[model samples]
Target: MRNVLVPLSCAALFSLGPTVASAAPEDGRPVADPSSSVAASGAAARLAPLTLSVAIERAMSAHPRLRAAVLDVEASDGAVQQAALPPNPSLAFEQEDTRRDTRTVTVLLSQPLEVGGQRAARTALARQGREVARADLDALRAEVRADVVQAFFSALIAQERVSAATESLRIAGSGADMTARRVAAGKLSPIDETRARVALATARVELRQAEAERVAARHALALATGQEEAAFVTLDGGADSLPGLPDEADLARRLSDAPTLRRSRLEVDRAQAAYELERARRFPDVTVSLGAKRSQELGRSQAVIGVSMPLPVFDRNQGAQREALKRRQAAEAMAEAQAYRLRAEVLSAAVELRARVDEIDALRRDVLPGAREAHAAAMRGFELGKFGFLDVLDAQRTWLQARMQWLDALMKAHRANAELERRLGAPTQQP
Candidate 1:
C-alpha cells in the first residue's frame, strides 16, 4: 500500500509539469534580459516619449534609492507601532517526581512589567525615528527631481547645439561652392577657394562634435528617466516668462519648507528622543512569575509567586546616556550647519538668477540686433564688391557666434530658474 501511494504521489508531481516550476527554488540563473519585465509591463510605453516633467516624475517613482527610502519610512512606522504595544505574557508547565514515587504537574504564567516609563520612552524614540525616515525620503525625492531637471535641460541644450552646428555647416558648404565657381571663372584666386574649403572642413568637424555631445546627452536623459532607449525620451516644453522673485523676507519664510532643512530638524528630534530613551534605561524593569507546584514525597500541591528585577550594580547605562546626549548635541549642530548652508545657497542662486535675467534682456535689446545689422551691411557691401570676402566671412562668423551666445545665455537663465525653484521649494515654469 505504501509503495502504491509513493508511486501515485510521484505520478501526481510529474503531472504538475511546468506549474511546479513556480514553486521550485531559484537556480541563481541570470535572466535573459534584465529589462524584459519593464518592457512587458508598459514601463517603456509610459516613457517611450517622455517630456521633462514626466521624466522627473518617472525617476522619482522608479529610482531604487528613492524607493528604498520610502520603504524605510513604512518599515519605521511599523516599528513605532510595535514599540507602543506591551510585552506578551509567557506560559510554562512543570512536572516533578520524588523518591516516594509520587508525581506532580504544574503550569505557570509570567509577564515582565516595564517600569520607569520604558515602553513610553521606546515608543517615542521609534516614532521620532519614523519621522526622520519620512523626512529623509522627502529630501531624497527633492534631490532626485533636481538632478533629473538638470539632465533634461542639458539634453535639450545639446540638441539645440546640434541644430545650430548643422545650420553653420550648410552655410559653410554654400560659401565653398560659390568660391569654387568663382575660382573656376578666374574671378577669385585659388587660395580663396582653399580658405573656403578649410572653413567648410572646420564646420563639418564642429558638427560631428556637436552630434557626439547630443548622443551623450540623450543617454544621460535616458538614464535619468530610468529608460533604456533614448528614442523614448522627448522634451516638448520651452522656457516661459521668468517667474517673479520673492523678497528676502518672503524667501526666508519659504526656506522653512526646504526638504533638506526639514530633514535636519527631524534628525534633531530623533536624536533627542534617543537621548531620553537612554536616560530612562537607568531604571530597572521588573519580571513577575506565578506557578503551581507538586511534590512527590509529600504528595502535596503548592502555589508559588516570584518577582525578579535587575540590580544596578556596576553599570548604570551612564555611558550610553552620555553618548546619546552627545549625539543629540551633534544633531543640533548639524541642523545649524545645514540652515546656514541653505541660506547661502538660496542667496547665491537668487543672485545668479537675477543676473541671468538681466543678461538675457541685454542680449535681446542690444547684442543680437547689432550683430544682425552688421551682418546685413557686410553682405550688401560684399555683393557690391566694396567689402572683401574676408570681411563678409568675419561678419557672418560674428553674427553666428552672437546667436549661439544668446542661446547659451537663454539656457543659463533656464538653469538658474531651475536652481532657484529647487532652493525655494516651489514649482518651476513649464520650461
Candidate 2:
C-alpha cells in the first residue's frame, strides 16, 4: 500500500483545535496499528471533548471502506510481483512398456519461455493496475476526511441552534412573568397573560426540538468517525469562523490534481497496457526441453535437447486484442468525461459557497441586528403601553426566525466549502 498523504490544510482550517499526528506506511505498505484500531472505541468513552482532527484520524484508521482500499493496493502489489516472474519448468516421465526387460524410459524437463515482450507487457499492465489502486486509495482518504469535517460542522451548527433556542426560552419566560404581574395589578388584560404563557410554551417546545436535533447530529458525527455506537461527545470547536474561499483561478489550477481525474487518467494508461499485453500475446511462445533419455534394451542414456512452439494459424488473440483496444478507447473517453464533470462540480460548489458567504454577511451585518433592535423596541413599547402584546410576539418571532436563518446560511456555507475541498482532493488555504 502506498503512503497516505493527508493534506495539512485539513487541520489548518481548524487551527483552533488539536491536531492529529499522521504516520507513514512501513516499507510502502500499511501496518495494522493496534492503538488506532481501537481509537474510535476509546474516543467514545473519553472524558474530554472530541476535536475535528482526532475524528478524522479515527475514521481514517478504523473505517471499513478505508481499510478495504488499503488492502486493494496491497493486492495489486502482489499481482505486479506475480506478473514479473518467469514461467515454471515442467518435468515429464514416459515408459513404452510395463515389462522391465524390454521397457524403454524417457525423462525430460521443459520450460515454456515467454517471447516477443510478453513478460514485459504483462508486468507493465500489472504496474499500471497498481497505480490505479493507489489513486483509488488517495481518493478515498480525501473522501473520508471531507466527510468528517462536514459531520463535525453539522453537529456544531446544531449545538448553536440549541443555544439560540435556550436564549429564546429565557426571554419568553421573562415576558410571561411580566404579563402575569401586569394582569394581577389590572394594568393588562387576562388575555395578555394567556398569550404570554402560550408564547412561553411555544419557546419551550422549540427548545426541546432543538435539543433533539443536537442529539441526532452528535450521533451522526460519531457514525462519520467510524464509531459503532453514538459517542455523544462535545465538539471542541465551532464553525462560526471558517477560512475564506479560494479564487476561481486557483480552483481551476487544482482541477487537474483532483484524485477522480487522476484515477480516470490512470485507467486510460492501464487499459493501454492491457492492449499491449494482448498484442504481445498474439505471437506464440517457445518451449525448450532438455534432459537424459534411457533405453532399457540398449542400457544406454542419451542427452536430449528439443524446442517447440505453438502454431498461431488458428488463434492469434484477435478477439482479446480487439476487446482490449475497445476498452482503451473507452477509458480515454471516460477520462475526458471525468475532467468535464469535475470542472462543472467545482464551478457549482464555488458559486454556491460565494452565495452563502454573501448571505451570511448580509444576515450578520444587517438583518440580525435590525431584527434584534425591533424586538427589543417592541418589548419596551409594550411595557410603556405604546404597543400591543401582539406586536411584541411578532417582533420576537421575526428575531428568532432571522437567527435561525443566519445559522442555516452559515451551515450551507461551510458545507459548500467542504464540497469544494472534496472535489479538489485536498484542503486549500484561504487567503
Candidate 3:
C-alpha cells in the first residue's frame, strides 16, 4: 500500500480546544495505538469524564466503519501489485502418433509480453484509485469528528437544561413554602396558595422531562463515539461558552482544503488514469513461444521460437476508450459541482453562525440579566406583600424561559461553528 496521509484533526474547541491530530498512515490507514489493548484494561478507568478530543480519537481508532475503510486501501494495494506484474509463462507437453516408426513427444513454453506501457498504465490507474480511497478515508475521519462534536454538545446542552430545570424547581419549592405560610397568616388567599402549589408541580414535571432528555443525549453521545450507552462513564464538559469562529474571508480559503474537495479532485485524477489505461489497452500484446521438439524415429531434437499477436482489424478498444473519456468528463464536471457545493455550504454555515452569535449575545447580554432582575424583584415584592403571587409566578416563568432560550442559542451557535470547522476541514483559534 502507498503512504496514506491522514487528514489533520480538528481539535479546536470552538477554536479554543487543543490540537489532537492522528499521524499519517504508512499503508493508507491511520496507525492506531497498538495499545488499544489498553482500551480493555483502561475501559474500567473510564469512570471519569470523557473529553471531546479524546472521544474523537477513540472513535477514529476503534470505529468499525473506519476500520473497514482501511481494508479498501489494502485491497487497492493488492490491485496495484497485481497490475505491476508481468504475465506468468505457461508450460505444455504433447504426445502424438506421428504416422512414422516412433511416437513423438513435445514440450512448449509461452509467455505473453505486455507492450505499449500497459502494465505501467494499469499500475498508475490502481494507484490513482488508491488515492481516491485514501481521500475518502480522510473525509470519513472528518465526518466522524464532526459527529462526535455535535453529539458531545448535544449532551452538554441537555445538561444545562437539567441544571436550569433543577434551579427552577428549587425556586418553585421555595415559593410554595412562602405561599403556605402567607395563607396560614391570613395575608394571602388560600386560592393563591393552591396556584403556588400548582406552579411547583409544573416545575417538577419540567425537571423530570429535562432529566430524561439528558439521559437520552448521553446515550446518543455514547453511540456516536462507538460505545455502549453505559460505556461513556461520564461527560465532563459544559456548554456555557461557545467558541468563536473564523471570519468569512479566512473560511473561504480554508474551505478549499476540505476532504470532500480533495476527494473530488482525486476522482478526476483516477478518471484520467482509467482513460490512459484504456488507451494503452488498445495496443495488443505479443505471445512468444520457445520449445524443444523431440522425434524418437530420427533420434533428434529441434528448437522452435515463434510470436503471435492479435490484429487491430476489429475490437480496437475504441468503444472502451470512448467510455473512459466520457467518465473522465463526468468526473471533471462532478469536481466542479463539488467545489461549488462546498462554497455554498461554507457560506450558509457562516451566515447562520453569525445570526446565532447575535441572538445568543442579545439574550445573554440583555434579555437574561433583565429577566433575572425582574424575577428577583418580584420575589422581594411578594415577600413584602407589595406584589401578587400571580406576579411572582409570571416573573419566574419569564426568567426560566429566558435562560432556556439563551442556552438554546448558545448550542446553536456552537453547532454552527462546528459546521464551519467541518466544512473548512479543521478548527484552531490561531488560524
lDDT of each: 0.79, 0.87, 0.85
Collision pairs in model 3: 13-17
Q: Mind sharing the TM-score for model 3?
A: 0.87
Q: What is the TM-score of each candidate against the true structure?
A: 0.83, 0.87, 0.87
lDDT by residue (1-431, candidate 2, tens digit) is 12333555555656734332235453666767889869966665674677777788789899888999999999999999999999999999988889897888889999999998999999999999999999999998888777778888899899999999999999999999988988899988999999999999999999999999988888878777887544545778876776477897888788879999999999999999999999999999999999888888898988989999989999999999999999999999999999998899999989898898888889989999999999999999988989988899999999999999999998898888788878897785331
Off by over 4 Å in 1: 1-49, 92-107, 230-233, 239-244
RMSD of each: 9.0, 14.8, 15.5
User: Model 3 lDDT vs. the true structure?
Assistant: 0.85
Candidate 3, residue 60: Cα displacement in angstroms equals 2.7
Kindly report which residue stretches of model 3 are placed more than 4 angstroms away from their true locations once superposed: 1-44, 98-100, 428-431
Worst 10 residues of 1 by lDDT: 237-246
Model 1 per-residue lDDT tens digits across residues 201-318: 9989989998898889778777766666544645665533454556788778778888888888989988988988888889887889998887766778889899989899988999
lDDT-based ranking: 2, 3, 1
Best-fitting candidate, scored by lDDT: 2
